[model samples]
Target: MAENGTGVVEFVLMGFQLQAAQGMGLFIVFLACYVITLGGNLGMILLIQSNPRLHTPMYFFLGHLSFLDSCYSSVIVPQLLETLGTHKMIITFERCATQFFFFTLYASTECFLLAVMAYDRYMAVCNPLLYTMAMTPRMCLGLVATAYAGAMVNSVVRTGCTFSFSFCKSNHIDFFFCDLPSLLKLACSETSLREQVIFLLAFLVITTSTSVILVSYLFIIRAILKIRTASGKAKTFSTCASHMTAVALFFGTLVFIYLKGNMGKSLWEDKIVSVFYTVVIPMLNPIIYSMRNKEVKEALKKVLRRMKVS
Candidate 1:
């Protein structure tokens, strides 16, 4: 702790600790990735908003997801780039806390939002007759609002509990960014109970979200199986391919990295997986959706043609 148990005024992020040449190389690579991630997500959102055909509840949720991805990636990547560039990775206490708050907020928001998308897919497939009536604009708006509200509350609770511990010993954070696990590891106080609470909440949150998605997909599967024609089943399942891929990548990485409750694992493999979810996923999400869905490709074509004409 810095000042009578108040904690350190700032943290020094030991991000990768590579040689100067390697650090610059990695910086260029990540900087390029960050730019592409921003472009892809922003483009997705704009295309969704501009195209009349994409004004449905599905696209509405997708647009919001793109927005969140853009923001979420931005939260961590800029500082990471800075760390790689200058080799002095320092973050003040207040700034670190703020970054952590928004990080949790967006991460949790994406979790719930993905679940909501799964539910939408379920309604479209299993309850096609009532799909339009079921997902009215008001209802869609309310569901999106609930996702944001729930995530915001969860972020607040977690961030509050995390910063409550005092960091007396070292100010060195092992990771590139201000993540919860690294922050917890730096604290001088006993954090067993806090860790338990965090683990329980993470368990509940991820389990509940993934369970809803799984159940929705189970119904979707049953409904698809009831179809007599193979083509019909193929078409129905295609609608979910993009979302299913995204959910898989997301949940898979988290399960690998943190399911064992070993966030303090400073292995290079762990860092790579963390980068997969935090940096790489944002870039991949737009590509996955755009590639799997014909509608998005058509929308991009229209947008490009209009741009050329203008």
Candidate 2:
């Protein structure tokens, strides 16, 4: 194993302090969640790809969101499962860093991507006639590309700064995975500067993306209100319902954990919130979108009918 600054080659991940029965129960539950997350996300991607009717800017972004959720959950959930099953898990510094890097990358990208999706909704709802012109295939690709590029830069900096601290003390991380706040507790060096830097970057990302979502939704709501009939307003609002629900669930937990007042103080609360966002949300996204979306439902029905005939 490669020595990371302080000759600490590996770190022990303390999954959760629980009795045998509790651990076993959690293991089963989390395993089920992981399976569903993978299946649902992958199915969403395939369904979108298979249906030409779903080939719009909205579904294009949704397809990528499903992909990111799959990868984001995969990065942390497997290690989390191992830790929960074994009670403790050992990870080399290099491997831990790798996991952290990818986790951050996928997560940050999703934040920006969600905002992009919101903007797509705004255009579709508020400027239906111009949506096709505004959200062209090339423009959609560019937006997704920009999200990935920005996230990559953030991930590189966070990984470098976080792992740079010398870990001269205990190598045991109290949390299941290699997260920033949990890992920071083990640092022997001064973390104030790096903490500020990390926080600033996180703040910029969360706030900027949040601004976009809020502003887009503001316009969306206004446009919905101006519709001639209640049915018209409801129909237009329904299209944004799924995306709004997703944004609330995702950004709610994110804001609570990362951007709140008592950050890192409530480790237990943090862990619970972390589990929700990391484990449960991925499994829920495909369900939320497919169930609320008429187009996706119709496409799924068509697929099922074709399968039966064969």
* Residue 10, model 1: Cα distance from true site in angstroms: 0.6
Tens-digit lDDT string for candidate 1 (1-310)? 2444477888988889899999999999999999999999999998998889999999999999999999999999999999999887888888899999998899889989999999999999988899999999999999999989988888888888888888876888888888877887788898888878776767777887899999999999999999999999899899999999999999888778667666744567777888899899999999999999999999998888988999
Model 1: how far residue 296 lies from native, Å: 0.9
Worst 10 contiguous positions by lDDT, candidate 2: 1-10
Tens digit of lDDT per residue, candidate 2, span 1-310? Answer: 3355465789988877888899889999999999999999999999999999999999999999999999999999989888888765899989999999999999999999999999999999988899899999999999999999999999999999998888876788888889888788788889889989888888988998999999999999999888999999999999999999999999999998878744466788889999999999999999999999999999999999999999
| lDDT values for all models | 0.89, 0.92
lDDT of 1: 0.89
At residue 44, what lDDT does model 1 achieve? 96
Which ranges in model 2 have alpha carbons more than 4 Å from their true place?
A: 1-7, 261-265
